[model samples]
Target: MIVKCIDNNNCSTLTLDKEYPVIAEAPEYYVIFDDKNQETTCKKTRFTIIEDDYFTQKAKATITELNYQLENEFKDIKQFTIRKNSKGEIKEISVKFKYY
Candidate 1:
């Protein structure tokens, strides 16, 4: 899952308006990789989910983790295809982004 920081909660680990990946979430908080790529627990109120997909291919991870050099290349994504299993677990995610 991807999330954008909304409040930052006066913490240094997060920056408002920046997108971060939610490695996991609990009832009241989310586990996110901080700016240093360290796992940090943050309150749910600090961020809002941007996208959540249940596909095994890890497309969400791919897109968010792609090298910065390619970030521009994948900007302006045109479409996405997500496949889910019977239990609603993601099986695959295929994204089509515009190429400059």
Candidate 2:
């Protein structure tokens, strides 16, 4: 199977017997299949995984909600971090506040 990292424009060809890392910084990508021997006349097909869409949308919503809550309830916040799991799922959010 061949996987293309849509955001980074990177491609990797993998065998069926080995494990691969599907999660990445930019989770958007397409899986492509192409025959190398018939380069001139071969047909290629690509597939998009919807998990990228779901995770991105969920992360955006979580970020927006956190920002709003922090702005209103924690005015001293100086920085924040959005944590994600191995599957690229949002796990936890941490914030640092300034003390005066």
Candidate 3:
């Protein structure tokens, strides 16, 4: 999993790459920065599993975390072949802003 900060107009993006089947989760406040650290204001952020493509011999479990977890029960790498994992696979989950 890789984390990044997007400094364009108060927005940031995070990217995660897993070799095995895993649940990708992000915290409600995924992108956080203290006002004291910087002169800019921080806004509320949200994350979601916009896309899911996990196939195994058994049923999968629900992902309910602010972080990513890998499931190696099947150990089969062929299932993910159709879906290529690369820099291009990154997806934007959400955008944040202040109410006022």
Candidate 4:
């Protein structure tokens, strides 16, 4: 998710009004990549969400999610491949379930 800094809270690494990319998040804090590309945690009140990114929206991308789905939801013979580019970006996701 993208977030714009509204309050630095006296953090020297933060610049007021600067936008940052939140690489990870939970309920109360955002793990944002700072201006220097350093991973840092900031309170949720420190910024306002600008937009949700791929990670936040990719509901079934994580291994845990895939395991749950493949086990409980798709309990059939299957094959899958998650294609990625050289840059490690997901290009395609292929799943083949049992013909039954």
Q: Please give the RMSD of candidate 4 to the true structure.
A: 8.8
Q: Against the unseen true structure, what C-alpha lDDT does each candidate score?
A: 0.82, 0.47, 0.29, 0.83
Which model scores highest in TM-score?
Answer: 1
Ten-residue stretch with the least lDDT total in model 3: 14-23
Write the residue-wise lDDT of candidate 4 on 35-99 in tens digits: 78889998999998787776656754666666877689767538878999999999999877678
| Candidate 3 regions with alpha-carbon error over 4 angstroms | 10-28, 38-100
TM-score of each: 0.52, 0.30, 0.15, 0.51
Worst 10 residues of 2 by lDDT: 37-46
Ranking by lDDT: 4, 1, 2, 3
On the 0 to 100 scale, the lDDT of residue 41 in model 3 is: 30
Question: What would the per-residue lDDT of candidate 1 be over residues 1-100, giving only the tens digit for each residue?
Answer: 8999999767987888999988998999999999889999999989887887565348656656555425666466777789999999999877676677
Pairwise TM-score winner, candidates 1 and 2: 1
lDDT of 2 by residue, 71-94 (tens): 898676789799999999999878
What is the per-residue lDDT of model 3 for residues 1-100, given as tens digits with 9 covering 90 to 100? 2223333343332222211112233343333232223322322232233234443212243232112223543332223223334766744333222233
Model 4 ranges off by over 4 Å = 54-100
TM-score of 2: 0.30
Candidate 1 to truth, TM? 0.52
